[model samples]
Target: MPAEKINNSNQAVAHSFAFVACVTCAVSTAHAQSSVNLYGEIDAGLAYFSNIGGHASYQATSGLVDGSFWGLQGTEDLGNGNKAIFRLESGFSTTTGESLDDHPHYVGLANDSFGTLTLGHQYDLIHDYFAPFTLTGGAGGTAFAHPFDNDNANNTYLASNSVKYVSPTLSGFSAAALYAFSNDAGQFANNRLYNFAANYQNGPFTAGAAYLHANGRGNTAGGAFEPVLLPGANRDVFNASVAKQNTYATGASYVIGDLTLAAAWSRSTFSGVTDADSGAVEPSAGFSNYEVSGVYQLMPSLVLAAMYTYTKGSSAHWHQGGVQADYVFSKRADVYLEAVYQSASSGAPAIINSADPSSSRNQLLIGTGLRAHF
Candidate 1:
């Protein structure tokens, strides 16, 4: 063969090899930019309740300070400041291996400049924004949640068949909204919800406000609250003929040195209640909760916190107090002791964590637990 022909053939092969190398490099770079993470927390403890249906009991509990759960979350860079994100989280009873369902399971798209949009079962705006200041929110856990979790600051209910939007934080301000579809053909208002929230945070101060409205409680599978999300018999809290429900909440927290002080208020109303076997019989019943809480860093690794909540309803009232001592063993684990005391009047039963209602008007609970995050 001619030398010139050989040279031409070699050039053709070299060009093809170069193209393959460039393609492989591009694919590798894109793969490296995407990330998937498995993260979760587990909290287990032994608790003693001075009164549960008038009987004191000792039991092993899970998720005292934080719910025991695992999750898979991931993001893929789509370039141009846009990305795709998804999360699937589940809760479980650490002692009995019972799986808790109706958690957040969503996939969405996000952008640095635009925002985020997600679909599936997800949290309402109140849980995202205003709950942080409350004890039952991410800060204090279940032991400090409001009575019956009526305000939903502790995420007692999750919205299904929903769409959520979250705006990027601007100057320490962020906002979010959620809408859940009832999926009841021809019954548009049967168990639908609309929620919105906003938050602002600065050096030492943070504030949040949120609103939520649900139509036709107990009329759908899981619009706002349902028995599936709770233990047996605990469904009595919302098991009634309620035409509508609304909640408004606001809170503010200030940090000074190692101490943080916070206050929150919420008003919840159930309208058009019927003469059912459970729930209020009035046309409308309302509940208002006032809370004041504080967290102090006793040392670098030890912390002390307390909260006092006064709740008043149309027919009853309650006073609740909570205190906790936490010791950090490391960044991923900790141990804590917490207690809650409650007193109710006007024939209202003292209920803790939606467990059995106390036969009397007073109830007390103490628990010690270990928590780890990964």
Candidate 2:
């Protein structure tokens, strides 16, 4: 009778194990149906400007090249090789929690295998790549940006009500297109912008081309800064008009061992009534900009970079140079020091000094900061 009882107990234990395995498999299958992720970065720094138009100041800032923000991204797997995806991102000041560009929230969606489409506040293609490769070092923050950031053309990165599409990679090549709406129903064309870009990467060589067009009103000016006052203009001729503008740029980069090299060129043209009335008497006035930069890794945790940029405006011209060094404390944190100097020619009014009535001037900046990611 005792041996019979032992055999019955063993059979019951085996049956219990089989039941647990079945339940585990079911839970795993359910989890595979959905996925969600959380991600973000926090970057802040202390900076000082020696001569901000004859004034010196100090402050703390965020998002030097990449803004600081937290976001959620997720996807739901529908059977038959299809999936639905979504993302919500927010940008805020690390020092004061103030939103950047008056926007605190952004959202978008896409398909799994097909190309992705997203609508919200986002960066144009030039800001996506060229800005970083140029004097701004791609960081729109106060530290690495170009002198007066005139070359940035007021984009500082990101636009409201932007819709973007990204194509899948084909042999290390991809393309993207974007459109931004002014969000005003009656003034459909006001502040509207469109951009397209193509890129290719193979081995240690990479190249890209991009185009941008903008039309409408408000502060969506085509240049880094508006032009200076003209001889015969009633209003502050410095203000850009609700006009049409077109821009194009191309760039390439190469990497060899510890050194990387890059170069880019861009042109912008402005037209319409405002431009004409403000002394752009001809069909339009434009500017051409060129940049070259390089980075060298001195150590596993240290990098040094330098860049030179030239802007030849149809109405003005300027030259700028910058140098920087960064030390990596870890993969997620780093400290950097940088300096930039800019000089204008007397041919026309200095573009960087539009606020002042000056034909030739020089400006300098120095800063140090820290950046972290999670």
RMSD to true structure for each model, in Å: 3.6, 7.2
Candidate 1 segments whose C-alpha is farther than 4 A from its true place: 1-27, 222-233, 236-238, 275-283
Best by TM-score: 1
lDDT of 1 by residue, 241-269 (tens): 56788899999999999999999999988
In angstroms, the error of model 2 at 281 is: 10
Q: Write the per-residue lDDT of candidate 2 for residues 180-263, one digit (tens) a residue.
A: 886665776776778898888899998888888877534334322133222111233245454666778878889899988888
Whole-model lDDT, model 1: 0.84
| TM-score of candidate 2 on Cα atoms, chains taken together | 0.75
Cα displacement (angstroms), candidate 1, residue 161, comes to: 1.2
lDDT of 2: 0.64
